[model samples]
Target chain A: MKLIYRHLGAIKIVALLAFMVFVCLPLVQMTLLAFVATLPHEELEVGQATLQNFSGILTDPNLRAAFGNSIAYVLINICITIPVALPAAYAFSRMSFVGDKSLFLAFIAFRITPPVVLTLPVFQLFSALGIVNSVFGIALAHCLFNLPISIWILQGFISAIPREMDETAFIDGYSRPRFIWSILIPQIRAGIAVAAFFCFMFSWVEVVFARILTTTNGKPISMAINALFGFQTDIGLVMAVTLASMAPGAVLLFAMRNHLSRGFRIGQV
Target chain B: MKTKDNSGWIFVLPAMAVLGLIGLIPLVTVVNYSFFEIFILSSRFWVGLEWYGELVGSARFWQSFARSSLFSMIILLIQIPLGIALALCIPRGRIWIGLSLVVVALPLLVPWNMIPTLWLSLLNPETGLLGRLGVVLGWPLDWKDSAVHTWVVIVMMDVWHWTSLVVILCYSALTTIPAAYYQAAAIDGATPWDVFRFIQLPRLQNVLLMAVLLRFMDSFMIYTEAFPINAGGPAEATLFLAVDLGEEIKAFNYGPSAARSVLYFLIIVTVAWLFTKAQGKLEEKAAP
Candidate 1:
């Protein structure tokens, strides 16, 4: 047993090293690309690093607006998804209605439905509504996907809370809205964080709907990166945009690190 | 027991309404379009089931399905075990565990399309580290033109991108296992394999199933990372289902695309249903 433990220690170190190298090497390279002025083979001295790539992205109105658009939609998506999911999640956790199971299953079904599959119809529908090329259109489309998962995750958290709290609040003359706002939400802060994290990650990274809906206007950072490859390729500039896109996620992950693993556990059950 | 009341409708109605406005409309429109040969929504001819019939016979459609299945299968085979092993290897010591988790999770935070961009730069033959290493080993990377290479690169990219989710799931599940379980196993002088079988595996089973559910669904429809790298190319080698659907939509093949999408949605829902059923079975089997 002692020998096995020793071997396991060595294995853990080796695995950790291998894992870091595998995961970080590419990111490190990409970061380096972002900082450098020119690719090595592209008529520039090796190690001639500069901050031009970052500045280049900010100065370009199109890329800057795209960065803004991506943030706007992601924020809009979380705003819509969480509020809509919360009440339904509360209902799911506390109350049972007719066809509740089937309706929930339908949500799971819709949640798994491929975004690509809905491209044509969603495009037609959105265009008819005159929301094509609009950030709000992207945000609304994202809600269709994000709301289900948001509900699923939030329901699990809400379920874990004892129903006795609700009774106590009511008995104490707490209004329903007051109870939810002051009691229910604070208790499920972690779950809300997790749900919002997912909604943010998915909506921020979502390319298909963002691509289809924002063809002529309101390109997100992803489209801006796409356009950066036209004619002459600026490798450094593209990597800068990619790195910028990851910032919100990185920030959120740091803030939610403690809640996330615990949140996933609740989600599984 | 939970409350059973009709008033639940009041709480759920908002979500249902929102979904109906956004979700049901497109869905109904898809079904509507599937029944017609649509051109620009204005020019249309009723062609009930024709597009579905065409899809049934289309070799390209079947090929994309096969590619997607294969890609998904490869992803599952790699990510699940790798994630589990990594999770187990995470030191139980508090500091080490936190550091391992955060480092492992870093890749997952990278946006989807950027994954390929990151990989492409890192695999650049002249400027990249791994590319240069490959040259030193006489196995220079060639994802640009070789179908086999493209498949390998994209599979590797997906694994790198998503394995963290599995790791996080498994790690969290591991943490839920009480410390006394290990102490008892040690008292019994249990081998590592025995301990894993009797304790860890049971706990891992659910999360692993979930990892499969998420990974399979996502990989089966992979497009964002893949399209940028090779655009489902080197002669359609990497053309997974979503990428194929993307091509059709880009071409404005509305009727066919709608029919194709309906079928695609059905496949995902069926797979998800199957997994959920299996999860139920597992729960039942475990229950006394």
Candidate 2:
């Protein structure tokens, strides 16, 4: 029994180490490549690493515009998603109304629908509306998916708060909106953080809709990176830009690690 | 807790309106356009089920569909069990738990486009770490020429990209299982397999179902990551349904693309619905 227990411990450690290596190796390789001055195919002198790749990409006018547009659209997406989804999620969690069940399921259906299914139609619609290639338009297009997911996650959080709290607040002469703002919103702060993180992450990373919905006027970083692929450019510069784009999400993850893990338990996202 | 007052509709109206305008309307438009032969932005004539017929009859469509299904299946088989195993190995202590989760989740945060770019760099024969390792192992690592190599790269990339989602979900679920259950198992002298089968697996059913559904849906619609790497290359051996649909859209083949899009939507919804129904039945059986 003692020998068996010792072997099990050894196996667990080995497994964990192997898993860590698998997860980290690719990322570490890419990061190292980003810092190198010369391509690995060219002379990979040990001390030739430089910040030139990062500086060069950051200063490029087109790349800067892409970065700005991506950040603008992602923020807009989160802004639109939160206000709209909060009320809807509250309604779904706290009240029952006609067509509630079916409507909620419709949102799930929308969530599962491939963005490709809606891309052409959305493009045509946006073009007709004269909002194509604008930040707001791309954000609105993203809301088609993000709004539903935000509601889904927010509803889960809202539902977990006891119903009696609402009744008690009502008895204390609080108006519906006031109670929701002052009492309920404070309680689900972690949910909002997680939902916002998810919205930001999804919008920031999404390419298909962003690709189709915007032209040069509002080109996102993903599209810019893709365009770079067309040109025979430096792989190190592309990797550097890619690493730079990952910063916002990495920071968000570290800051909200506790809320996210907790939120996943309650929400099912 | 049911309210007779239907005033909640007012609260939901704004969201519903937005969803209607963006989601429902576009969906309806796609359904409508599936019947039309679009020649230009303004020049379209009603074809009425002709495109659907063509889609159904096309060998290419079926091939892409099968390829998509196979890719999803392969990833599901690998990622699900692998994710569960990784989640199980995560230390239950506080600092290790947080550290492991953050590290595991890092790949998920990388933009989809970058994943392919990153992998491409990492697999370049001359300089890439994987390519160097491949050379040392004396293996043929030509992703551009070999279907098998492309498939392997795609699968490995996907597993690297998404298994973290399953791990996070399962880890969260595992944490919620009370200590008392494990204590009870220990008192009963349960073997590790018996304990897992009786306690952990049973507790994990809901999360596992969720993980399976999300993985299936996302992997089935995989586009951005795989598209950049090879764009379904090596003689189109990796061309998935999304990539196929994307090609039609890129080439401005609106009619057939719309028809194919609707069909793709139905397949996903049907599979998801069926999975949910099956899970419901299993839950009923287990509890009763």
User: Best candidate, DockQ-wise?
Assistant: 1
Global CA lDDT computed for model 1: 0.83
Q: lDDT by residue for model 1 over B47-83, one digit each (tens)? A: 9999999998999889989999999999999999999
Q: How many clashes (backbone N, Cα, C below 3 Å) per candidate?
A: 0, 0
iRMS, model 2 (angstroms): 2.3
Chain B TM-scores per candidate, in order, are 0.92, 0.93
Model 2's chain B yields a TM-score of 0.93
Chain A TM-score, each candidate: 0.91, 0.89
Worst 10 residues of 2 chain A by lDDT: A38-47
Summarize candidate 1's per-residue lDDT along A77-195 as a digit string, tens digits.
88888998999998887887888888887876677777888777788788889999989999999988799888887987888889999999999999767898999999999899899
Cα lDDT tens digits, model 2, B99-176, are 787888888877787888778878877888888888888757665788888888889999999999888877877776
Superposed Cα deviation of residue A164, candidate 2 (Å)? 2.6
Q: For model 2, how does the per-residue alpha-carbon lDDT over A1-269 read when each residue is reduced to its tens digit?
A: 65755576566667877877888878888889789765443445533687777997768998999889989998999988998999888988888888887888778778878898899999999999988988888899989778987897788788878899999999999998999899999999999988898898778888888888877689988888777765356777787888898888899988877766655554322
